[model samples]
Target: MGIVWRAARLVERRPQTATASSLVFVVPGWPGHLPGQHVDVRLTADDGYQTVRSYSLAAPGDGDRIELGVQVVPDGEVSPYLAHDLPPGSDVEVRGPLGSWFVRRPDQTEPVLLVAGGSGVVPLAAMIRARSRTGTHSPFYLLYSARSPDEVWYRDHLANPDPQVDVRIVYTQQAPPGSTRRPGRVTRGDLDKQAAQLQPDSPVYVCGPTGFVESVSNLLIDMGWNPAAIRTERFG
Candidate 1:
């Protein structure tokens, strides 16, 4: 459905990490959404320069409200506005519950491997939430890399990495004082370790900044998995 009205409040805005905010809107006439979908937001200033942007849905839908994970880009047109100008109880126009191409369902039995870079873990997090909600016991592996411990999104929930779901974090810029996972970049060797630990038949989902997604995807193909078995989404 298209956006006929705007939300009354911005509702809730919470920062997940230093660079991103988790926003939930209590919009009336809200339509349901799949985990990995996104919505287009239209922003207008009083002076008449208008802009529109698309952002991924952070939380899965049970029907009422929609949640978005937004990263504040310095000097970015939309992000900065969201970070500074837009506030809880503020009004904005959004049209969505849109995008059919990227929705994920865990109805099948295949194990899922999720690889993410920086703030790009937004959508992949939703997929993980979906798997958890359905009580599906499929094995999941999450390889997320960030610049520092403070920069990694979803860091808190990953406190205990289960046998079925593996979580590995890499710090490219700097690791905190005495960290465990290796420092530097997310290399092919890291992907190899994840692949080795996972069952051979699992399907993989990779989302992140362009370079990390490309590098990881290439590494997977080079490691002998079929190209079609790996799915990807890039967030710029």
Candidate 2:
């Protein structure tokens, strides 16, 4: 599809964690997108200096309105402003619903495994919501890795009890109270337990920082998941 820049206004904003936020924008002419799609946000300064960054759509499409989950990169050029300085009614140029290979279509019926690190859960969260939104019964297992309990995004949505989707969290820095697993990066043992619920052919999607994605993807491949079947997206 031929995508062009469009005007988007921040209609609402909410904190997801200490360093992250969810921004809701209402674009006048947003083309609906699939789960895992992202948009390019262009920020222009007072002197006309401009910069752009890509952010995955945090929510399933709803008319001209969309949501983005942003993690403040302490020294980043754009993220800091979007997560901290941007206010309701502010205008920013957006151009996307971009990306293709990592998306999940609504009609897909096979079981799915999604592994996310830190804010990487943003897009996977959209996939989970899209599943529920369209009434698709495909079973999903989401294993999320965050630095600590307070850093997990979409806390309520992931915690909501659901028989169809199994959600798990691994803390790399601080584990939640009474949690069994001590603070650590995800390991083969973790995958062993979750992989038991899935068949050999089930598709797996992994997203996170470049290093985290690489580490998780290698782990999945070692566990007999087909290399071509494991889709991945990485940032930073």
Candidate 3:
């Protein structure tokens, strides 16, 4: 069946990082979605003006509940509302569980490499959660890049011990005290090191802003990773 717009109630909200928050909604009859899917959220003002924005699902759910991690964009419309103004128990319009290419299937046994920049980690987080929920032993590595330790979404949750998932945080602007690496963008060396942990045929999914996605995807191609094996989704 085609996806439809439905009214969803904001049931819970939690702060993920300094600039991001995780919003959970209760949607009745939310046809189950796969990891890496996104939904379009629509908001309306009292004057009947409306705006819509798409957000990736942060975790896989059993068709009744969905989570989205929204980063407050400076001077943004929807994001600011989602991050701060919206209150629990408020109603929002949602449409989707969309996109098909970037999704991860549970039966696949190959290693998975997920790379994210800034808020782009949202969909990748769904894939990671799905892997854990299904009890898949496939080695999964997440290379997440943010401005600093404080800006990394789900930092505490990513800290939770999971032998199957290996997370590496790359700080671009600032690094915590005593950190060995200098603050910088993710380098070819970083990708090389993580790629070594997975097989040559392993699928790589990269998500982030346009420039970040372009740079990473090009680097993966230059690294001899098969172009077809690298799936990318760009936002902003």
Which candidate should be chosen as best, given lDDT against the real structure? 2
Q: Please identify model 3 stretches exceeding 4 Å from their true place.
A: none
TM-score of 2: 0.97
Q: Give the per-residue lDDT of model 1 (tens digit) for 93-182.
A: 777877675667645567777888887888878887777777777777888888888887766777664557778788998888888765
* Cα lDDT tens digits for candidate 2, 1-236: 58999999999998999999999999998989999999999989999999999999988889999999999997888898899899899999999889988899877889899999999999999999888888887789999999998998988888893679999999999998999999999999888878898876788999999999999988888888888889999988
Give the per-residue lDDT of model 3 (tens digit) for 1-236.
68899999999999987778999999988988988999999998999999999989999876699998899988997898899779999999999989989898767768889999999999999998888888888789999999998898987779983787889988999998999989998889888888988765679999999899999988888888888899999978
Q: lDDT of each prediction vs. the true structure?
A: 0.78, 0.91, 0.89
In angstroms, the error of model 1 at 80 is 1.9
Give all TM-scores, in the order shown.
0.89, 0.97, 0.97
Q: Provide C-alpha RMSD values for all models, in order.
A: 2.3, 1.1, 1.1
Clash totals for all models, in order? 0, 0, 0
Q: Alpha carbon lDDT of residue 140, candidate 3?
A: 90
Candidate 1: which stretches are off by over 4 Å? 1-8, 160-163, 180-182, 199-201
- TM-score of structure candidate 1: 0.89
Q: List the residue pairs that clash in candidate 1.
A: none
Question: In model 2, where do residues sit more than 4 Å from their true spots?
Answer: none
The CA lDDT at 30 in model 2 is: 91
Judge candidate 2 against the unseen true structure and give its global Cα lDDT, from 0 to 1. Answer: 0.91
> By lDDT, highest first, what's the ranking?
2, 3, 1
